[model samples]
Target chain A: MSSLKTPSTFIEGPTRLGKAELAALVAADIPDGAFVNLGIGQPTLVSNYLAPDSGVTLHTENGMLGMGPEAHGDDVDPDLINAGKIPVTELPGASYFHHADSFAMMRGGHLDICVLGAYQVSARGDLANWHTGEPGAIPAVGGAMDLAIGAKDTFVMMTLQTREGQSKLVEACTYPLTGVGCVSRIYTDVAVFLIDRDGDHGGGGDGSVVVRETHGVTFEELEGLVPVPLRRP
Target chain B: MVTITQSALDAVADIPDGATVLIGGFGPAGQPVELIEALVETGTRDLTVVNNNAGNGDVGLAALIGAGRVRKVICSFPRQHDSHQFDAKYRAGEIELELVPQGNLAERIRAAGAGIGAFFTPTGYGTPLAEGKEVREIDGRHYVLELPIRADYALVKAHRADGVGNLTYRKTARNFGPIMAAAATTTIVQVHEVVPTGAMDPEVVVTPGIYVDRVVVVPTAATPRPEEDQ
Candidate 1:
């Protein structure tokens, strides 16, 4: 249980991490040599920090593996792109498949990890990322639902709070769920959430959410923000 | 051997009104813009179309949607920064949308082509996307029953094709071409070039000739990179 605790030397202050710093934090946590999918938006920034030779294979749901960094100048190939539709380069040993086989890699548990951007994550690790379930909003579910449910582990990278200062971590996701109990860890600007799936992480021997790390705020402040029952690490 | 034509319009001239069409591409990477433009010229209407995105900008799929041809769209991601045509029509209640999870959409299309009646998948289980679907628990995990999504025609794009229609794609542009080719009753491909029957290396053929019905040489200008269009 002690290993689950936030290190005593962790920096906690009013100065928060910039988006790049947060991305680097998430990038540092990904296991070396793992096959990972980085979702569009903020999660895509995590790719910049990953070394090309880290043995980390990037999977784009549009049908590619071993995706390299963003293409520049003459290296840009419209045919070679990431899930975001931006032109990119292919690393050595890159392979391509059709949409079906690409999704199969995720759904069949062939992918090691997938990083997604979330609107809300529940105490039970429920994910709500695809749609806002709004009246006027156009719903686009891209590969979020698949990435959330299919990958071996799902990690969410987002800001800790809404612009209105509301916590993203809640007791239950009000938005339509992308997957049920699929999130394993969440890396945010303010904290790293370790979700205990059916008492797997010793989160007080229950499937509770634990705060493994915190920055820009105190543990008490973080607890006051989230609506879920939290086990302070 | 497949019928090879030099005209994009001639290639898609037989796609009648009110047909179910599967348009290949992930965004615009592999979208057969020439074939879609020809479909517009045919003045087709009341179509049920399936693709990854709804449309982007005022061209290709967007142009067809703007021309009031599509009655329904079954796709995973329909809303994007440049999806004005789909957004305007959808908000005005002029179109029907069935939003499937990406994985479910792909597998359903694959199942339709592979002759599978239905299969259980864990992709959208326990989410709102699984509404009215049957869920089964196998080995302590839940999966929902998903049906196939077959189509009357498929419009695809590939880098090159042999005389008999063996296809080879370029990079990620190969996204949905092969699967859509198999999932449709008639598959029409628009390629930049048509080579001799034995020209293309057999080992590199992404989509076999059996799944393809027709091929057209669009004579694209040396694979020029288009503007930054997502």
Candidate 2:
């Protein structure tokens, strides 16, 4: 055995937080007794990082509440799955309902927080996660639209920039909007930011974006990459 | 006397061409595979299917779409990782698609069951999904007017059913089954077991007999299929 030695390589560029670290950062901010819904992709990892004793209840849009972390190996129950179609275990006091009833809980503003992955988030908090507006792109809207507008706080968990280094946090989203001014905070690999209405009652009171936290990148460095002016409050 | 059919083929024989059908399941847990296979065997054409996702692999709705029986699909998530059939058909312009938000899709079906003409929902408020739809502002929040969606037929799978069609589903497998049963003009269910009318506890029944129009007993997996030997 080669002992699976860790490789030491030097690359000169801005370091970004890994997926697990990003998830842990988002999970730390969730308060106890909060009703939360985790979106399908990278945001689903947030559930795994929640404090073991925390009373946070996870809601799946496919008619389940109090969902636990992803089930593994022999523990996987095919019937008990999450919105992502992965087998999951039910937490204590778990309850199941109809699909419409689950969405009612979502659209009824019963969720305290919802973390989602986005293609782009505008400075005014407009979310565009479903379709990229590219021709021939399969548009699968899923539960994103409902969760974006329904949750009390919608926190986006994604990389700060695209693989091509295009900033996802922009002045205005070029993609089709999922919800207007609905995003509360964004958790990217490089930094975390809280979105607010730009200016003093401009653009329906949806205005500038501000930085709240940074990982390896400085606030100024992150702001330099974004399309919009970043306010440091 | 419950309307129980011995043949899955006979249960779906009455479904005509160009029918809007509601299929129950999240992925494959509660899909009426036998009924779908029977419908495929019957060669019903130009079907408009309504479901959560398109289908999995080469079974269930995907098989039907692969056979070119589906003319259109109205669903929330139609393109899954393994949904190559739908992707191929959709890209080829062989089948039409009406993408709906998941919550909106479920609520539209539920609204049909509840006899609601239309209702305003905040799901697709400011997105492209809200385009060409009526928008209203109540309490300074915008909501889009969504109409009820009814189907000509509903094919659902249940864990068990009473003789009179009272249904109780297993765990998370119960998704969209009860609502689809109520939202269609003719609802047909495939179940593993059928008990006596009063055998099931009243509190456990998810779908009442009144909503269900037909019931069929599905063969258990332990029993071998005749085709398997061939």
Q: How much of the real interface does each model capture, measured as fnat?
A: 0.80, 0.65
Best by DockQ: 1
Error of 2 at B21 (Å): 0.6
Candidate 1, residues B46-164, lDDT tens digits: the string is 99999999987788998999999999999999998888999999999999999998888989999999999999999988888899999999999999999999999999999999988
- Please report how far candidate 2 places residue B198 from its true position, in Å: 1.1
Per-residue accuracy of model 2 over A80-101 as CA lDDT, tens digit each:
7888888788888999888888
Docking class of 1: medium
Q: For each predicted model, how many residue pairs clash, with residues at least 3 apart or on different chains?
A: 0, 5
Task: Please list the residue runs of candidate 2 whose C-alpha ends up more than 4 Å from where it truly belongs after superposition.
Answer: A1-15, A197-206, B221-230
Per TM-score, the best of the predicted structures is 1
Q: Indicate the fraction of true inter-chain contacts that candidate 2 also forms.
A: 0.65
Give the alpha carbon lDDT tens digit for every residue of A80-170 in model 1. Answer: 8888888899988999999999999999988888889889998888999888888999998988888898888888988889999888888
